[model samples]
Target: MKAVVTLIFLGLISIALCAVSIGDYSDKNHPGKCNIDGRILPPGIHQSPTECERISCGDNGFAERASCGKKMIRNCIPGELVDKTKDYPQCCLRYFNCNGEIVKA
Candidate 1:
């Protein structure tokens, strides 16, 4: 009985440690967003209307600003890339009243 209880306790502790290691607990300011070295990043594509404007969360976890009119804007989050045409099709593609939706053009 003692050995069984000890094994169960160890298992629970291991599970808890794994959860903590893999959980998203960095962003204390913004929920559901990643806080990479104190910068909060959104999930989807972030855009700026002005050219040479500095985006808040650009470049994969590097806090770099991507220029407007570029073909692709690097997302701060890992494994995410935002197409400038899709984010701002009006400016890049000459479409009128584009809603910045992820749609097939």
Candidate 2:
């Protein structure tokens, strides 16, 4: 019984440790490469293969992703909102009518 309890506890601990990684690609895993959808990207900003996120792969072998910064409707006169139906950058890039002028943001 004690042996079984110890094995179960060890297994739980291992599972918990695996769960702690939030899927961030690091140098420890693939040095200087951002592996997105099985395609290796060098250290630089690149578009995600499966999402609208802009991935920035640092030289340190870490990846940081960004999409639309924030949706701002202030001073926008019926400006264009994000069209999720579109592709990568076009999906997030929006045009706004500010002060009666069309502004691309």
Pick by TM-score: which candidate is best?
2
Candidate 2, residues 3-99, lDDT tens digits: the string is 9999999877544432121245664567878776676778887766555566777776567665544456787765454565565456665778888
Total clashing pairs for each candidate: 0, 0
TM-score of 1: 0.21
* Model 2 segments more than 4 A misplaced: 1-24, 27-29, 69-88, 93-105
Please, what are the lDDT tens digits per residue for candidate 1 over residues 6-31?
99998775444321112242354575
lDDT of each: 0.40, 0.63
Worst 10 residues of 1 by lDDT: 72-81
Candidate 2, residue 11: Cα displacement in angstroms equals 48
The C-alpha TM-scores of every prediction are 0.21, 0.41
lDDT of 2 at 67: 56
